[model samples]
Target: DNIWGAVALHNFIEMLRSFFQPVNVHVTIADGNITLKNDALLEILKA
Candidate 1:
């Protein structure tokens, strides 16, 4: 059940990523590194 739960969440994240445009989200770039807000990274981390 635990494994299934993780899988389900992973799949949901993947679906969301497919539907959502990353480019639409704002990001900051400095020192040759792209920085995104915590919420943005959290969203990607979900996958």
Candidate 2:
């Protein structure tokens, strides 16, 4: 599906960014849902 493909691309971008970034940015699927979790993202979410 297109949604899954988009998620894959997003995850790939995040993975590449993680190399130069400090925070561990990554994505995964949980219970048929997309889960994007990372310290940088967490902080943004908390703000």
Candidate 3:
């Protein structure tokens, strides 16, 4: 189940990368927290 979860996450990231081409996308999971970084996303949120 953990492996499946990882695979699903990888696929999701790949999908996001394609959708946000030309922008750097990063995802970090630590201490039970998830952090995502992307300038494009920030712009969307600021709008």
Best by TM-score: 3
Q: Of 1 and 3, which scores higher on lDDT?
A: 3
Per-candidate TM equals 0.43, 0.40, 0.51
Alpha carbon lDDT at 19, candidate 1? 88
Error of 3 at 4 (Å): 0.3
- Candidate 2's C-alpha runs over 4 A off are 22-47
True-structure RMSD, every candidate: 10.8, 10.7, 11.0
Model 1: how far is 34 from its true place, Å?
32
- Per-residue accuracy of model 1 over 1-47 as CA lDDT, tens digit each: 24565488668767767789454443333423433346454455445
Q: Rank the candidates by TM-score, best first.
A: 3, 1, 2
Top candidate by lDDT:
3
Give the per-residue lDDT of model 2 (tens digit) for 13-42.
Answer: 787887777566554434335444454554
Instruction: Give the lDDT of residue 4 in candidate 2.
Output: 74
Q: Predicted candidate 2: what Cα RMSD to the true structure?
A: 10.7
